[model samples]
Target: MRLTRTILAFALLAAVAPIALAQSQVEITSDVFVMNEAARQAEFEGNVMVVHPNVTVWAPKVVATYGEGGTTDIRTFEASGGNVRLKTADQDATGERAVFTPGDQLLRLTGNVKVTNASGTVDASELVVNLETNVSTFTSTGGGRVTGIFTSQ
Candidate 1:
């Protein structure tokens, strides 16, 4: 009888563990919003704000997609219309438009992108960022400028 009780307890704990681990919470705010229930996606318009974990992003409009099959693909995160603001522990970026591929941890910003960190600030017409590697490439189109300001702190 004691052995059977112990086995049942372990089985119950095992079943609940996965449930707790797989759960996620997302919060979004905007002037107007629409959600697709079947796809588990959302679109926000007019001063959109998205917060997940330690990251916060703000833009004029944003579309968010989630992955299927218990993965963190994120599918696509696109921000347009106005400047995008992304704040994380390591860095911060601002641009006119931004697209992020969460699975790859890649962020592409265009139309006057500017990135600032403890090191300095880089401004360009286009910026591609690899979040995982902390590397960024800046480029210009039609006579753009990149200005860096380094401070010793």
Candidate 2:
């Protein structure tokens, strides 16, 4: 019975270990941080930076709106200030403004958006990324055209 219990305990631990490690929390830092509980919003300004497991964001200002669950259940994140940038393990992107909707797993960047990766670089007036599907779409408005420079690697 003792040996059987030991084996079962090890199996349980192995099963739960991955889940614990996967729940990496996001961290944000900036020169100023403000929370408005009444509005269910939090704002970071002056060289705001956010670090997550998959990506990092840098901007002059970022505002996060939470659902009823508060900060843990963020609904939307908006970043603005002429030079918003995001960096991932494989790519980097910059734009004048960026908005992320967690529920839809969508990120939208507008105003002179540029994305660069090992494969190529693309420039557009707007960019939409579907985080869940790992797909990105770019578009140019006001009678402009999307441009890209790709290099074979």
Candidate 3:
């Protein structure tokens, strides 16, 4: 079932409004959309898909929490499901859950996370990326080990 895009568009606007990029239009769709203005939160479920100029995400559910300062400021953007997949110009990743904290410029993916790029592929129980420092740390759980394969340019 298709729902109206107007509400979703407005909700997403608040999420991307802070971006100064030239083309920052974001298109999001889902079978369900729940918005709480007072709480400054929006939830999308069932075939949730978000498309931005720099990245695209597909998941069964997504929750966006905005900051108190204003709707334009997003605090946390989270995607969770059996299989959540995200793609960008350079990489593709899949995990059970992905959470991004805009305030700290940090992204965390957990639960059998696997990331692949032109350079290589990495598998771990969790992956944390600090966008501010441009660092990615991957680790495993339950005595498991993180593994990856790389290719020389």
Candidate 4:
């Protein structure tokens, strides 16, 4: 009886171990640029790309906010005249200005935003994506357009 109980406990532990060890999300690449060490304020420039399980982001400049613990708290990412591309398992988006909130897992893009998926493409002046809910919202300023392309595979 004792051996059987021990085996059951071990099996339960093994099953739960993986779930506990798994991270909420993952990041692919990051580049941080610091102006002054004493200030702890920095700008991340260059091809700052991040690939999560369901989304990706590309930005040129990202302003970082640090906490007293010397760690990052928030980041305001921006890309002007450049492009910000995002992709997931089922959808994709591109835009000019991309703002990301790492702590909240939110992304907002403005200026000629385009989203494409298995169904079609949506074009708007502004776009917002919530990673936690996997939902996206598109808004337009003045004029907006949505184009759909269908190709048989």
The top-ranked prediction according to lDDT is 3
Which candidate number has the best TM-score?
A: 3
Q: What digit string (tens of lDDT, one per residue) describes model 4 on residues 65-109? A: 444544323233344436777676887778887766655767788
Alpha-carbon RMSD, each predicted model? 10.1, 10.6, 4.0, 12.3
Expressed as tens digits, the lDDT of each residue in 55-146 for candidate 2 is 78899998877778645566778889999998989999999999988778788999999999999999999999887797989999999999
Instruction: Score each candidate by Cα lDDT.
Output: 0.68, 0.77, 0.81, 0.57
Which residue segments of model 3 deviate by more than 4 Å? 1-11, 17-23
Model 1 Cα RMSD, Å? 10.1
* Clashing residue pairs for model 4: none
lDDT of 3 by residue, 25-127 (tens): 7777899987776687788899999888878889999888887765566788889987899898999999999998877878899999999999999999999
Candidate 4 positional error at 1, Å: 59
lDDT of 2 at 42: 73
Total clashing pairs for each candidate: 0, 0, 0, 0
Query: Arrange candidates by lDDT, highest first: which order?
Result: 3, 2, 1, 4
User: For model 2, what is the alpha-carbon lDDT of residue 91?
Assistant: 92
Query: Candidate 1 residues 21-117, lDDT tens each?
Result: 2324546678986655466455679988766655678889987665563223346778888678878787898888888775677778898777888
| Pairs that collide, model 3 | none
Which whole-number lDDT from 0 to 100 does residue 9 have in model 4? Answer: 32
TM-score of predicted structure 1: 0.69
Off by over 4 Å in 2: 1-22
What's model 2's lDDT at 28? Answer: 71
**lDDT accuracy of residue 45 in candidate 1:** 91
Candidate 4 wrong stretches, greater than 4 Å: 1-32, 35-39, 75-81, 102-105, 145-153
